[model samples]
Target: MPERGATGPRVLLRRLREVMAQPASAQVRLDRIVKIIAADMVAEVCSIYLKRQPQVLELFATEGLNPDAVHKTTMRVGEGLIGDIAANAAALNLADAQASPKFAYKPETGEDPYQSLMGVPILRDGRVLGVLAVQNQTRRHYTDEEVEALETVAMVVAEMVTGDLIDPASLSGEEGRIGPRLVKGLALCDGVAIGTAVLHEPRVEVHSLIAEDPEAERMRLLRAVDELRASLEELFARAELGAMKGEHREILETYLMFAEDKGWLRRMTEAVEQGLTAEAAAERVHNETRARMLRQTDPYLRERLHDLDDLTNRLLRKLVGEETAAVYALPDDAVVIARAMGPAELLDYPRDKLAGVVLEDGSPTAHVTILARALDIPMVGRVGEMADLLRTGDPVIVDGEAGEIHLRPAPDVLEAFRAKTKLRAQRRAAFARARTLPPVTRDGVRIALNMNAGLPFDLPHLAETNADGIGLFRTELQYMIGSEMPRLNAQSAFYREVLDTAGDKPVVFRTLDLGGDKLLPYGRQLHEDNPALGWRAIRMALDRPALLRYQIRALLEAAGGRALWLMFPMVADVTEFDAARALVDHELGRLDRFGKPRPADLKVGAMLEVPSLAMRIRAMAGRADFISVGSNDLLQFYFAADRGNPRLAGRYERLSPAALGLLRHIVTEAEAAGIPVSLCGEMAGRPLEAMALVALGFRALSMPAAAIGPVKLMVRSLTIATAERFILDRLTSPAATIRRELEEFAFHEGVIV
Candidate 1:
């Protein structure tokens, strides 16, 4: 697109490299770089704004603007054009700056006459380090090519912004010292843990961007690409993946298409040929592609960028000769910090060593957080740019209850955390002594405290929690973790281990509840605008009857004369429950015909997750074995909110009147049928919520391992009749929510929070 011997991103990078290599001050290099960018982009103005912390960006260098504006103009992210680019981590191009709606007049910059503006985020890894901008006096539109080129240059210069070259001089105060930083985030799981930060996907540091020998770098790039292609081919050819052809096949082929893309290969080769190292070349193209993709308004397209980013991570590691195995060798007291992670990635870390997990990007319902809760590992998420703020082995404290982290905290802070932890430990110790004691309330009401488990890792905690039984063993996790369709034998073996671990203790396995967000690795994900309400759980299992039969058969075979308590999830109606139960009956008959061992006792139940199921409980009374209220899904649906969305987290409460009425209906229906009902999910994990559930006549409570002690303590303190009377009295109110009154009651009763 440029004339021969003229400039573009590559040329600008080359010139910037020369300037960086020069023996000059940081100020001079910044001044020269701005001038060079202005000249290269053929713009009248160029400026650099570096982020000093989480909130603000300061003008560091500029050319063709008011000289006084340099180091004087400051704006918080989202304050101006530069701020918008920084806030969104995207490029903002305008043909007319004054005409733009987001335009903010900066008198100090003295650029009121400029009509055109284009700014791109300077990024390192996934974090926005600063912003680079160019403006023109005449009305102008920046082409996609120009935006891409500038973003590429910005990537190359992001390291300089973060490094010592500008550090000591860039900061204006003592707090600017690059030491430890504290940040707050949303709590995903409950507990407290102090540990060292372990980056899940540690950056593959590329020291040399500009190569001494371009041809050699080109050859290196070619070899890496070839190896990468071969690796993908081998993955496709794997014997285990043979049956995965139609299911997970499209994913591999899509990856193959990217691996074999001519344009992608050319970009790498061209970058290498133009004096960049193989890793650097790949990084350049990857950054350029990401910068473009992440800026889009469409979420689906933005999500697709992760595939390319992952591929780049893999390629960079291969180019640098780094082994993936070594990257995951977790240290003691490890608190994993990741930009994001899949369920499998979270499972790979040893639970014994993994004290906590901190996600820069994640939701409450993410399986990683779910599993962390099961393991009693503290977790916090949505801490933006956490990886950039934390270094591996940096001392950090994860306060999941408060949803805060202290990086290299002061001694007094450490002592305070230790004291708090000790008090919790002492309380847990007291509860531990009563582990063998009956879970009976003060007025002699028996409570069935249980644990929610999914994996073999959860088995050990059962004894520790002193649970009466496993209330919800999510069978979907095994299928979710696998790469392909697991055969009947494999399914049976996994279920057998879960049964064996439970021994004499009762275990209620929730049949495969995959779909919605809990998608299988080897299954086609349905396209749905509102996934939570779409085809999932019993809906999916019933559509494919064979799949449901196989799991039922496995459960029967694995029980080996022991009683089997299995439940169906997301039962929209009594008919769905009947249909699901019919599958189990068919499996039982087929197993009987084949002389296969069946459960000595079989109890079928429906998960009361949908409000429709609660309404139809009168019809399901004699038909259903028992009912378990899935409080997580129930609350979200009752309030018409998505549980995965952080914004809606505080919108509803477990003790809301609607929730109380819905739950009361289930309890009343179950009582009329003389069948037991349980309340499980995140709500049961909190002591106050657990107390409210107990008050609502939910005798069985299944929760994360860490919650058992506190909940049991709450149960021991309450008289059920008194709690019921109090709750019923409060429920008479027409108010939408009763959480405030419930909290007051818990306080009056001295329930531990």
Candidate 2:
């Protein structure tokens, strides 16, 4: 076999461009192109399979096989060796094509005689447009140079198919219109919204594929990379982002690392040297990287694909002299779509225009999801291949509550969602009207309804919901959102602002709940098999005394004669609480030593997230001022379920007999010890769950601001004694979940929940 080096592929590309430039029908052009690829690579067969639909790939042109099979042979996305390449968006080079498990016999194509095969996906903007493959009779592995040459040719072919050179309709059999479709995903936030799809970080088209001057393109590529790096540095230096330290900053740093990556630059430069424009080179390299990474099952590598795509798109825009930070002119009721994005990228869009967000890849704990919650935007994530199914400006109904996305929905479906949205609005209005009313039951039992908050955006809801106080002020958010560890003064200023915003309303400040999934950018991350159970929250704080001391100092400075309500998170035992409280004591002593004004009233509490803490509730009540049940973590721990895992979503019910019994035990112990206890996790925000907690003798509950009204309404309508009797009786029942029974009780009793 002859070595198809730099000159050979370039020579073939030059000839292919000549054929493409000629005035001919799409079929004639495709036929000639395949022949050129076969002759150049010294292969017995060459074929082009174009994606006509989402799942189906059709052979449009071929050489050295049954010529009659052109436009006749078809395969699904993952049916055969060709389909496997398309499905994974990666290249395949097989020594024995028939011996591969992925090989599927297609008698129509007469491909059985071919023993050696090499296939590469023709990718455009990270979407697999088609598969370009070559085969030979002899069983021999294709060399690296041969594979690179074929990939370069595939790049040229992608341009041809998408371009007017090959009429897409003639090749596929249908127009480009995508019909009505429904996609299911995980609900990251709650709400229903109807909107127009606005693709986030839209691809910059490469108008010029082949380079007129190789040296010029190389220089252009080098300049764009330098510009890309400088722009990222400038973004990092911005005052708003500079002081932030968390995953968002870490993501940007990763982006910068990709921008400056020597290997990434080398690959693009090599592509340019092989006869492609700077933009085309960047696109090709990214396509290859995306193909390789997409095949990886590792979540970390799959996630990095988004970062790589983002960087490549930025570089492409730079190469084309387009605005690197171009702001999109969003349509009314815009539903932003992306593979995945950092919080900062999501923030670039105007909040008012954004009706919701749909991600092909995202997690409930992702930073972008946190931001979406803060902005009060509905979000649905892990909706695979959404980009392929829907185009920009397509009508989209995001049913966040159901975790469903209806693309180009039917008129009736659209109307149904509109009605649902209106009904939701009406319910919210009703809740608002009754917001200021005290949450006192019909039997005159008073329940304290507080709001959980983290971001400054949440502070406004404190007044809106008429919450008694801030029950869980997640202080780690301030640390998470910045690019670097927030300085002492920055932390103090932020806490002070939060306190100022609340005014007279008490705020329970939960100290930095770092580590585990919520890792700090500057802090060292430990490799743990189960991060949730590993060193985090109180454990991490106790281990790093300075972290606790620094936050304690900030809270003290922020309080300055005001009341300070501090809480430690994930305290497994009484000893951890004692150690954490000692740091607080140390901070108070330091304030005294510095002659600084301390909080007028100080209250230190421990979150009962760990099941062990529940066992030691009596011991904890003796030392701690109050106990806030972190039901989200506590339930997961008790049930041995990972809350973040979608597979375990409904496996363990929150209203289960065992879960309620555990909560009842905690409340019983807390009441005996004379400590004011509250339930503050997601269970509190839910009306039905809140009803059950109230029955379990929890007088105080903290939830998202949106839940306050509904929970309050339930509280105002409840007969606590009746609910207690009903719930306690079912505690001994063998049901997997008591949700149905509770709902029945609520309905019969006229409980608003």
The local lDDT score (0 to 100) that residue 178 gets in candidate 2 is 66
lDDT (10s digit) by residue, model 1, range 187-229: 8888899888887777788877777777888888888888877
Cα lDDT tens digits for candidate 2, 1-753: 444445577788889889989899877999999998888888889999988777888899999888888778899999989999999888899999899888999898888789999999998766788999999988899999889888999998888888653444444343345688888899888899899998887668787888789998899888988988887787667786676554445555655676677999999999998888898899899888877776654344455566677778778888887763327577868998888776546756767788999998887646577667756789999887676667788999998887999999999999999899898998889898898799999999999999998876678789888899999999987776554799999899989998998999899999989877786645665688987889888888888899889999999999989999999999998999999888888888999999999899999999999999899988876699999999989999998988767799786689999999999999999989899899899899889999999999999999988889889889999999999999999999998899999999999999988
TM-score per candidate = 0.68, 0.72
Model 2 clashing residue pairs (backbone): 244-482, 244-483, 244-484, 245-482, 245-483
Candidate 1 — which residues are off by over 4 angstroms? Answer: 1-16, 19-123, 127-184, 188-190, 193-207, 214-274, 278-359, 362-378, 386-397, 406-419, 525-527, 644-650, 734-753
> By TM-score, how accurate is candidate 2?
0.72
Q: Model 1 residue 58 lDDT? A: 81
Q: Identify the leading candidate in terms of TM-score.
A: 2
Note the Cα lDDT for every prediction shown: 0.79, 0.85
